[model samples]
Target chain A: MIKTFLQHELKAFWRARNTGKNVAVKIIMGVFILYLLLCALSAGFFLDKILEHAFPGQNIVIAFCGIILIYFIFDLISRMQLQELPTLKVQPYLQLPVKRNALAGYLAATSIISTFNIIPFILFVPFIIKVIAVGSGAGVAWAFVGSVFGITIFNNYLALYIKRKANLNGWIFLIATGILVLICLGDFLWHIYSIKDISYLFFGHLISLPALVLLPFLLAVGMFYLNFLYLKDNLYLEELNSKKASHKSSTEYPFLNRFGTTGDLAANEIKLILRNKRPNSAIKMSVLFLFYGLIFYNKPAMMHTDYPVVFVGMFMTGIFIINYGQFMFSWQAAHFDGLLVNKIKFNDFLKAKYLLFTLVSTLAFILTIPYVYFGWRVLIIHFVMYLWNLGVNTTIILYFANRNSRRIDLSKGAAFNWEGVGGTQWLISLPLFITPILVYLPFSLLHYRDLGLAVLGAAGLVMILIRSTLINKLEADFYKRKYTIAEGFRNK
Target chain B: MITISNLKKIYNNVLVVNVPQLEIAKGESVGLVGNNGAGKTTLFRMILDLIRPESGEVISNGEAVAGHENWKNYTASYLDEGFLIDYLTPEEYFYFIGGLHQQTQAHVDDFLSTLTDFFNGEILKKGKYIRDLSKGNQSKVGIASCLLQKPELLMLDEPFANIDPSTQIRLKNMLKSINKQHGVTTLISSHDLSHITDVCDRILLMEKGRIIKDIATNSSTLAELEDYFAVGQSVISSLQIDEEENH
Candidate 1:
């Protein structure tokens, strides 16, 4: 029965309407995975030397043991974000003669085949063989490997269980992520407890007493049983479909009522982003990227150079414009005909898009205010980028948006689902990223960094002042291609 | 109030809509009858300026619709599900449309009171998004939205196709009264000959992207249309047989 189920999945994948595109994406993903595996393998081979250099005079085995725990913690967080639960696919088999346990077991088993599972083995197996086996007996080395495998499987099932629960109640997802973030902060920032010391105490014991490996092995079995039982009890169609008992309340933007038609349109666009799956995910990702400056700005070496700061500032302030604007028109491809025939001016429509971009980029800029901890210069650069994103990048995004005729389905999941991407998305990035850089590069090359900042800021201010003229031109461009866009939308 | 001169649309070297000349007068309820792929929807799209013509143009109220926005001020159309913003509830969608035509919430409420029977108690206050509604209910929402604007011209494609039998009758009566009372210029395309003949003053028969027959809806109009379609059925059957044999 599991074999039959697997066969059906294979056929469904191959027979999908976007099979040709999916094949191309799969090839790219395959090459990417292979490249990552190669990097991990080489890193594993040199782990002993790296550890020796980092912790001079410390036991290399103890250092390796301490690092493994930290790696797993981060691995667990990534799995929580990226792993997809296959529960929905089991709906068809619920009514069949197959046992519920088997179906649940199959689901849990299939998730273990993920790249997350393989990548760790590629990264750590070599370290175990080269360092542990040569130092300790083969039995202890194999025991350590078994414990690693057990922990990997344990994280896989644990992530699946939490994600399934999160699907039913969004608070679960928030709480889980919150706890993980708190743990990371407590370890990295506060230094209240040393994770390295705790890891060394636990994993270092496994090297001498192979019996300690049973801890993870038993935990893996316990998690798998819990998942299997949960699935069995909640296999009903209604529970699987929408388990929530509360009705969703509607939101009212009372302040927006003042702007009349343009405000109404912008409000509708906001509701679209909040309510739909794909756009909602895009908005969530933008929120996640808000903290992106921490990764770059925290490094003392990075602060000396202005280019990286500029790049980070532009990305932090204008993330929404780049992420959401790429699908500006295609977002409404489902109803383009209705918009074209409506009693609204093309100019008003363009104005509404510009207003929306300004609103979001402004909000993003306000959110990045904390980045000023780095310096007031950082804040100034962000303000300029925000202006450029509002005045210049918005127009660029909308203009290129007109050229993209592909339709995007709003209900599909955003992860790895490239339904609407095309060559235009790639082409638009060049001007958006390069134009500002070109303006900055010449002045920066001459060591006139302040002048470079002023030039970028001036251009952005100029674009904002003449935005109405730019809108008129974009409106004309839209009229020229509305039919082709409509035709493309209708074909899908 | 609408004129099409030398209008044409082609897709991949195949002509989809080709009309040398056509005219619709003010307050004229026109019915377009055609089979699948007969360019009925295409013609309506062109009239609304949702699609551009290969040559010539659609002039609505003496203004060419392609580059002008004036026609939409008094024109309303619903061609398919594409016309609906499926994420909004029916009431929200109606209010949004009403707001576009400058109608206030209270005014929209008063107007919606007249559509209570047309809504059949399933659409308004249903607490469901338009996408979640049944197809028949969605059609009612679309038709109701089109009427909410109180436009000088209105267009609907296959309004009777997905609606229930009883609502179809009520809708036919509603359309007839709206046209009579307000002198609204209405254009509707449908496969139901009886409904079209009962509601429209003039019927245009289309075949293969061409208007084959134009007749006022008289007492015998339905019978004449049936005879033409019966002959068309025989020709289609014979062509299918020939293709099968050739293959």
Candidate 2:
């Protein structure tokens, strides 16, 4: 029965797409898996070489363990955003007499085969072949592999447990990260309390080789057991029905209500964005970028050149426009059929998207104001880039909204995601970033910092003001191409 | 029960649903038939106030349905998956439909008891969500939901397209009882001509957004009905007048 279930699942998953989409996805994942493997091998080789200088006998195990822990953390964090159960295809199994524990086990085992798990094996296997297994004793090499595999299992299972159990906030990830950081900086923190020596006594001590292998295995087993229990207990009632999908109780967003009908519509659109994961994540991610400058900008000496701020600022704004704008139509993909069918006043709908785009990018622009707090010149250039991003980059993005064929997972969280992807999305960034630089770079170089700012700002303001003109032309154009957009959005 | 005036939808100077002013009275079962893209679904959506016509008014009991989104609570409609909430179990789906119609769980319970073999204890289980169900099971759930409500205006689009023969008979019987017992004004659309004839008091034949012929089941003989739809026109078929009257 289990074999039949698995067979049915594979057939359905493949059959959900056309041959082309399935082939393309398989090829992409294959290339990605290979790339990860190569990266892992190099890191392992480098780590082993470094530790060999300090503690030759225990070097391979120490290097391998360190690599395993960092990779485990990375995998666990990624897992939080992933659905343990695939959603689109899972609906067909509901009426069957399939047991919940069996379903849960399938999800758990699938979690182990992740790309993150594959990467470490790719990197370490070669290093073991070239260095550890060749040069180190048999017991030493065997112990090293055992401990690394155990740690990988530990990371994979812990992530599965937390992801399956928790309310799944991004902060849970930050808290996990903070604990690891404290561990790394344990000497400094321990010294803060005058226990630096004791910290060294425990941390610096040499534990038996067997203890390292034993610890991760124990943790992995414990987490897997906890996951099984969670499945057994909570496997009864299905999650909330789509009709009653919980949301922040509808609030009177009078802020957007001032645009009259447009405002009211825009306010409702904003409410939709706030209620959904992908759009809301856009807001969350942009706010998080505000701190990226502060995180790495702690050292004044490393800032010998102004490259860091400029790169960070450019990258930050670029990230927002690229990530948020890429899914321009997909955020509304589900309801576009209804919108097109209804007497929605089409212009208002487009206006609502523009309103949303401007609102979010403006919020991002405002958050980046502290970049000026670095220095007046850094501030001016950063402001110019931001204004350019709003004016030119955003408009270009909305224009490509016509052509963007990226499939957005409307169900996934917006913060740090993998939902929207396609070759077109990667290509969109070139124009969004380059156009702004071309317009402003020459003017700034000619001793016109303030002038460039005014021009960029005006251009953005003009785009916002004249959005109606473009949308009018676009509406006519889209009517002719409605069939194409519909086919593309549906991936038919 | 329903009245429509100048019901026309124009997209880029092309008429999509050029339904002239028509009235469907209370206690009538209507089968709205059309070929692919003949505007049957469009006309239904507009009548239900799901979409607006370019220039028309649809009134239910003198209340303009266009301004009322809550018309469906009284007039049950299942168009595509628009009505099905994927996350709910069949029981929950039944409960929701029942709730909107102001019916209690006991009403649903009593209804289910009549078809205990068909339901097979699935209704009592709250764990299984609707999305996990098969297409045939989902349709059964949907059909079961509408009947549970005991609606005044029951609208279903191709409700029997994928269901098993056994379940289909169960549905046909259930709908026949509700229509006769409550005098429910029903509008059902299907490609199946036989089923439509079995149930509908009035069957409309549509082509290219126009109702070419409207046949009253009481008036027309099955031979005459078959003759009207024959591939080529004959002398006698074209000669018939006052065609909507009794057999």
Best by DockQ: 1
Where does candidate 1 clash, by residue pair?
Answer: none
True contacts kept of each: 0.51, 0.00
* Cα displacement (Å) at residue A410, model 1: 4.2
DockQ of 1: 0.41
- Candidate 2 clash pair list: A40-A123, A41-A123, A91-B131, A91-B132, A94-B132, A391-A460, B219-B245, B219-B246, B219-B247
Docking class of 2: incorrect
Residues A169-222 of candidate 2 have per-residue lDDT tens digits of 545544664565465455343545323333223222223343455655677777
lDDT tens readout by residue for model 1, A1-492: 778888888987797645775677677767867887888888888888989999999989999999987888888898887665563266567787989888877776777777778877887788899989999989888888998889988998888788767655555666787798888888888898878888888788998899999998999999988988886776674443432323434456777788788877877788778766667756766787798898789888988868887887788888888888887888887777888888877787788888788888898899999888999999999998888788788888988888877677663333223343332244347678888899899999999999999888888899999999998899889888888888767655
**Model 2: fnat (fraction of native contacts):** 0.00
In candidate 1, stretches whose alpha carbon ends up further than 4 angstroms from where it belongs are A1-32, A80-114, A157-174, A211-254, A284-302, A306-312, A367-374, A405-446, A488-492, B4-22, B37-39, B51-64, B125-128, B207-212, B226-247
lDDT: worst 10-residue window of model 2 chain A: A199-208
So what's the TM-score on candidate 2? Answer: 0.62
